[model samples]
Target: MQGHGYAPPPPKRPSTGALVVLRVIFVAVPILSIGFLAWVAPLRAAIVTHRRADWWIFGGSLVVLGISFAYLSTDHTDDFSSPNGNVGMIILLLNAAACVGHYLYADIRHYHRLYPMVYLPPQAPAANYVYPQPPSPYAATHPQTPVTPPAPAPHTPAPHTPVPPPPQRPAPARIDQVRAELDELSDYLRKRDGHYDGGRDGR
Candidate 1:
């Protein structure tokens, strides 16, 4: 039965014969090749190694090439001149030396495939891969209104219970009724004092 398994091994790398052929073409093309070598190899090496030395080498080679051309142009004599007149030839030699140095460094790196161009498998996701939750169908149709807390009930000052005016002194006992009650109270007190005095006289 067909079942899933680990991915197959990567394809094998091709031979370098084509690259060799291309290098020959660059060398065969006269003036253009010098310009190409001055820039291409050092730039490629720099890109791979991220080294400042590679770039410095490229700049130095380019300056030397310019000075060489300038000096060569000023010398009108067809015969090879002495030391002073051969400055252009000397500078050209220096430029060639720089190109050879850069080429050797780049060649070593290329042989080891230190910075090869090959397809790499995509990296697996991190361990904390949380699957996104699907959106609810009802959410769009019935949007939930935000539930705001109910405002506190207004405070009413307890209805002023109405103290009932202290029972109104029993309606003042109708004035005459009040006088009759006071007379009865005074007679009882007088009788009580007289009885106490009689008992003392008897003793």
Candidate 2:
């Protein structure tokens, strides 16, 4: 939506040189006349700020000028020849021209040339919808298919062989059997000792 009228915010203006000139003109406008100072200062200020006051002042000034003209139209000849009156009127005309011309210059300097509406447009609710993009040709006709995962590989049982148990060792001899063998060995040794003693005595 914003892409339609993406005009940049007005440039940061009142450049150094332009500001110097405005300052000079602003100072000079006051010196021209008290009436002009009262009117022009606000107009110039509003124009530089790009606000609604400039329009109001410009309209108000024209209305006042028209009313003053109608009042003065009845006695213009008498007023024209009066001493210093002509001079004062001349000064007033010049001041008005100067004010209008300076405000115009401000408008041209600070705003874009192509579009007056660029600076200030009538308020309205902004557009909310965007244009739709065209659909892709391939997606319309082809329609994507869901991918099937590969079937789980078949489970094959490995050939099984029973493992045999190890052979058992014989049980240990009883304690009574071991005692009897020791007694037999002691008796043989006693008999041999006795036999040797008998032989020695005979000698």
Candidate 3:
């Protein structure tokens, strides 16, 4: 049977060099990290850990970054003097905010938190500590009555003499014999009463 208590191994943590590279990329090119690396690293934790909130937070940040980028590109240039420019600038600022949020959440919160938890060696049990055994879920609630085995059945002595077979009942007469007898009786009765007809008898 599959065990409910057993947990599969945690997802592998990123290496020191890889983690360093990731942090550098996130700091140097926040947009690149927000757009792509976010999916690669931060979002992966949400998937591996089956954390729905992380999925939404990381995924939503990426989406916001994407939408703002696309919006700013189409006739929304970075010219703060004009009206479209102001709106575009606001979008860029929002996008930057989203990128920062993503970096903090993914790199700082999840990366640091998840790595140590997953990669750290298991701690040895203390010498004096006694592990408490969990109570069995299948334990009986009430004291059970002791079950007594039934007494050995008494033995019967076999008969010394050969037993005779049961009397066989004679089988009833066959249909043809029964019909012949009925016809004879009928003819005798009919002749006695002066009603006998020999035509049926081929006489």
Whose TM-score is greatest here? 1
Best by lDDT: 1
How well is each residue in 1-203 modelled by candidate 2, as lDDT tens digits? 55677777965544558866766676566556543453565477576656676667666665554544544454447655643445545555655655555565656555544234446667765586576889899988998899999999999999898889898754466666777899999999999999999999999
Q: List the residue pairs that clash in candidate 2.
A: none
lDDT of predicted model 2: 0.62
Tens-place lDDT per residue, model 1, 64-99, is: 777877887788778538453488777775566566
Off by over 4 Å in 1: 1-14, 26-51, 79-84, 111-203
Mind sharing the TM-score for model 3?
0.36
User: What do the candidate models score in CA lDDT, each in turn?
Assistant: 0.67, 0.62, 0.62
Candidate 1 vs candidate 3: the TM-score winner is 1
Off by over 4 Å in 2: 1-10, 26-46, 78-203
Positional deviation of 147 in candidate 2, in angstroms?
A: 79
**Which scores higher on lDDT, 1 or 2?**
1
Please give the clash total of every predicted structure, in order: 0, 0, 0
CA RMSD per model (angstroms): 18.1, 18.9, 18.1
Clashing pairs in 3: none
Q: In model 3, what lDDT does residue 163 have? A: 82
Worst 10-residue stretch by lDDT in candidate 3?
33-42
